[model samples]
Target: MTSARDIVPISARLLERLEALGTPRDRVLAHAGLAATTALSTEQFFAFWRAVEEVSPRRDLGLVVGAEASERGYSVASAAALHAADLAGALHTLARYKRLTCPEVVELEVARGEAHVRFHWVLATSEVPRLLVDSTFASFTSLARRGTAGAVAPLRIELARAAGDAALLRERLGCPVAFGAPVDRITFAERALAARFVTADAEAFSRVVPGLEAELVGRSRTRSLRDEVRLVIARKMSSGARPSVDQVARGMHVSARTLQRRLGEERTSYQEQLDAVRRTSARRLLANTDLDPIDIAFLLGFEEPNSFVRAFRGWERTTPTRWRARVARG
Candidate 1:
């Protein structure tokens, strides 16, 4: 099971909404007891989440909190009101403030062509993935509504996997849903970029951006170390090298001891993380690349072809050669 420490900095807006539902703050904290004992184990957190869902007033609590925060003047919308000279400004505002609300999972990036938004959440036990997708769509819809054009529809929604509530998705988003896609993204048209917003309080927006970013940065520091470790391993493995803890620690500007301590806190180890990356990379390479076993071994940082064979057997319980043959025959 994953750990609650794995899902820190939950949507503050969602938490606020849950709190406002007349569920006492103590009850909420009790539900999140793992925060004190240890990072909530995945199973424990999920079970707690299920109980919350059973009593949750708004299933889309993130959206509800966002809306409430907008009203209270401490929200993404308020940040937009500060400098959102136009639609682009609003998106930039969201990208800046979103982290204060949810850490590590949802990310927003803007490029020349379009604004890219992604949500990679580890669902709390009580929460449903569909709720996340729906809430995200709704949140974006709220932002769109306040935009220059007053709520233009999204160009497309690509789902990494299908959700249980397809009909709810169709009704709420009113957009084409592409399931089983390699990545999940919501595409906004370039024209949507030119739309104008009614609110243009740049001075106010400027003041809020910094404070919000500071809070977000503070919250993110704790979660980022884990993600950084994962990223370092992935990058090293992708470059055809098996990185040691010391190597990764040096790269991350931390001592090996510190890295190990942090991973121990998260109930993982450097070696386990490295192995996970290698296994995942191996599967992708086997499925997509035409490289032979010995070459693949070298690419994965295996010094000996036999070592690669052994590792592959451990991962798949079959020889790499046989695995490739099976895939080919299929």
Candidate 2:
């Protein structure tokens, strides 16, 4: 029952996971009109996934990428989950705040001495992409493994996608992988739920949960014109995709002229918002990650590294490498 208004954007942390796997984060973000800093709506994220599926040669791209990702990619919810007393508490936290990550429904059902953690995509589309399901289950497994310090293992992994490379999933997860199921779900032993997290800190949860809850509340509120446009531009810029004014205007459900007029009233333009998002995102990536300048340029929607360099120079009066070094020094 997730609505467009309630759909959450893909987090920069999750996007970084794909970046680490050499998935050309820039193209993905650009196609979705998203920046690394912008959270993508479910529909926008789906478009990015379609773009990924179209280009990736491996049919198991989602599974492969998801397994290698770390809990750092889970963002604030991961922080809250990890602060819990045990795996059950962590799973519950994720299920409750699942909307913060995406529009998918997360359900934890306990029965017959087992816990079934099901992920359901409530899309209105004709069909759900297999890659999305694969990625979600794989990422969920990876996070669970990390949260429980490698002690937890899925009893079984089930997917709605047709069976493909089941052995690979089995090997990777150390559990049976079955497809063509009624839903996408992972089953774990009831005892696993009681297993304490290695990094557990109830006090930390007390301090962090309120802020995350508050953010969820705030996001559910209204967004400004600039905010909406910036998000669209960030998604579109992912893979060197230059978003057009008309495209953005259509996305916001308004005509181009009206969109432009409103932006003027807010003292900004489409290009200005795009530039600000890219610059801010580039600076963040440079300061926070070890990704090379070339990759950073690609993520910023530049056709070539030199273009990004030129733009960065214009913004910061120095090259990306030099700026990163400067950031490191301070």
Candidate with top lDDT is 2
TM-score of each: 0.55, 0.59
After superposition, the stretches of candidate 1 with alpha carbons farther than 4 Å from their true spots are 1-83, 105-115, 121-128, 149-151, 216-226, 229-330
**Regions of model 2 farther than 4 Å from truth:** 1-4, 26-39, 68-70, 123-126, 219-330
What is the Å distance of residue 81 in model 1 from its true position? 7.3
Query: In every candidate, how many clashes are there?
Result: 6, 24
| Cα-lDDT of candidate 1 | 0.59
lDDT, model 1, position 80:
56
Top TM-score hit: 2
Q: What's model 2's lDDT at 296?
A: 75
Model 2, 121-195: lDDT tens per residue? Answer: 433232345677677778777777877889998999876554577887787767998765434579999899998
RMSD (Cα, Å) of model 1: 8.4
